[model samples]
Target: MTRSTGVVVIGGGQSGLAAGYHLRRSGIEHVILDAQTAPGGAWQHTWESLRLFSPAAYSSLPGRFMPAQDGQVYPDAAHAVSYLADYEKRYELPVQRGVRVSAVRRDGGHLRVETDSGDWRARAVISATGTWTRPFLPAVPGRRDFRGRQLHTVQYVSPAEFVGRRVIVVGGGNSGAQIAADLAHAGTDLTWVTQRPPRYLPDDIDGRALFDAATARRKALDAGSTDTGGVAHLGDIVAVPPVRAARDAGLLHAKPMFTRLTPTGAEWADGTTVEVDAVMWCTGFRPALAHLAALRLRGARGHIATVGTRAVDEPRLHLLGYGDWTGPASATLIGVGRPARDAAREIAGLLGS
Candidate 1:
């Protein structure tokens, strides 16, 4: 069965919710298709020990603020999940849970979204599927031969599992620093392997600074200027209390990425080897656009060709929360709001015209 709507939002995560907020304001008839049985998108799956690098205020949706509970400086994963779940209910967003979208194809003038349960037909489609399920691991020599357990950042839960075990955490992003800190605090042996030293913001600042800087950059770019400078490199590690404490204890140092993985551990480029029981890959993620493969809009970089969130090849389509490629900081909770809002406006305009 196919139901018609003004727009069909793919993924009911932060970005999808943000889009829904604006689309509802515009009185656009839209349906949000989510694969998860629950409301919190990726937040529900994050590890127990995981907390936002910033405070609750810095990480929030569009209309409502994530209230700080128990004066917790940074909200934990459960806190975030609860907030997201409540936000959906409070907004009365039209979300269909456990509806896995298998593919989306252009049917002449409209788009048809194929799902496990049913199909969705809409005048416009906004693909908000984030990168949580598509964790990326770099190809290394002898990676398949490594016998030690290899896990992505998504599979990681807590430091308790690594206690008394030597583990190598790879990646220079916030996840690598945060996870390594968690394990080190628990007395677990950890080796931080990164392509370069991880950069950290001042202990005083958090994601707010990055958000402001990105806003400024977007304004500047829109005004046809290239000079967008304030807080540079927003994706760098934020010196949250835990990470700061880890740095003070001299546990945040990083080694150059190893050349290859051995059965027992990893081998460095300079003839050095480190034996580890597990390799935690905190590398990164690619775009979760597999369902859109049938549309043939993806480019060589595994990203859809988007003309500022709108698919360049498909006029009735837009993608949100992919990464900087879609918009500056589009993957962040607060950051996705602007892109989502703009996408909604564009979709409304197209459906009206």
Candidate 2:
């Protein structure tokens, strides 16, 4: 049976939840289809020690604040998972877990949302499948031939797996820096690699500052002023306590990108080879938009042409939480709400019309 809905939201992650929050408030008939069997979305898949650099109060969705537990100021992955689950219950959101959306196509005036379980015809569709499931591994020469283990950030769980082993952590983003620190603390011999110089936010600043700076930069750009007064880039590392400790121990340093991979490990441009047991590729992720390939909305670099969060080529669709390109820092816990709420309001208006 093709169920008819006002809006069909894909992915029940933070972004999707935020969309649902606004949709419910707007009295729109919507259902969120999540691929995961549980409520936590990608947070449940994050590494054991992963945490939000912001305080609990700042890391909230649209309507509810993320409550701190046991005097914990900054929430961890588990807290985020539980909070999201509770948020859904609190809002009475219509989220259907374990229903992986297969594709979204035009059904006359509505969208035919094809999934494994059933089909939904929605007036508008919100794609909020975050980057966690689509970790990117840079194609280095000889990487395929490397005999040692090569794992992407998606596969990374804990540093205990690399204990007593030589490991190379690639990329200078938050994931690479955090993984490097965790592995070092676990007694793993590690080398850090980055495409360029690593940028770090000041110790006092956190995700809140990052969001504020990004918002200012976005506003300036909109006003034809790209001069964003030395604000920290969103990708820059936040000095969380553990990361600070690693910086103090001199383990937070990164070298230039290696040239290629060897059977044992990686080779540098100068022919210096480091034999390592594993390579942790923290390069980052692309949006999980494979299902939407049929829409033909994506442009170069696999990004869809978006005006705000709405896809330009397909006006009925909105892509949320991919990154700043979709909406300023929309992939973060606090950031997702902005784009999601905007998209929800837009969807509601569209459905009403």
Candidate 3:
């Protein structure tokens, strides 16, 4: 028999959990379906030493605060996973683990969500899968010819795995920089390849004061002002400035643009080459919404078109955790809760709750 619910959340990560928490508080019945066996999505897959650059005060779910004192650094990947597990148990959120949602289609008035277990029907659906559903590797020449074990950062777990090997970390994003620095300290010969110059910011820039400044600048820019470009260009919000410090220490080498991958290593656009034993692609991630083939997507990007905050074409569907609405804040743990709450309120109104 097909199961039915008032709402079905597609992911069980921070955003999804927050959505579920809010919905439950508002007396909305829903079930969360996650592809992973556990609650934390990308966090469970992150490297061992990864910690939230945002303090614990900002990196928290809806009801419960992160278990840390004031001004304490947020937990690492494992600690985050444990905290999420505890949150699930504490709230008694109904989550179907290991049930990979393969397809979602509109069936009459309700939506049909097909997973490995069975099909589910829901009156409303919130796609909280976030932006990291799929690792996006750049289409470079000779990628297949690379005989080294090339893996995306999502599959990376620890630098100890690359102890004595020559490792090449690709991309200049937070993940690439952090991985390069971690492996460098682990006695691994490391090289970081990026197409653009790296940008950095201090670890605790004025102690959460930067957030208010950034938010204000972001608002002013939204109101059509160009005076905030300097603050806006201060690198990604999730980025930790210490990565550049590692580069200054001569532990990381930022190379030119990527050209091709070879059996021995990688070749750059400047005719330079590095013979590395392993390659970790920290390029970034993209939304994995291919299963929603029935929905009218905004072309190949798979993003739903929106006017203001409401979805233009599909009013019943909603997108949370997208950077477009909330800026860089939407994608971070600190930024997801507000959007999730807004989405829940919108969904509730649609359901006549």
Candidate 1, 162-224: lDDT as tens digits: 888999999888888889899888988889989877778877778788878877787787788
lDDT, candidate 1, at 337: 87
TM-score of each: 0.96, 0.96, 0.88
Q: Please, what is the whole-model Cα lDDT of each candidate in the order they appear?
A: 0.87, 0.86, 0.75
Which residues of candidate 1, in runs, are more than 4 Å off? 227-235
Q: What lDDT would candidate 2 get against the real structure?
A: 0.86
Ranking by lDDT: 1, 2, 3
Error of 1 at 154 (Å): 0.5
Task: State which candidate has the highest lDDT.
Answer: 1
Q: What is the lDDT of residue 191 in candidate 2?
A: 94
Error of 2 at 136 (Å): 0.5
Tell me the deviation in Å of residue 156 in model 2.
1.1
Instruction: Write one digit per residue (lDDT tens) for candidate 2, span 123-213.
Output: 8899999888888887799898899898998898998778789999998878888888888788789899998888887788998888788
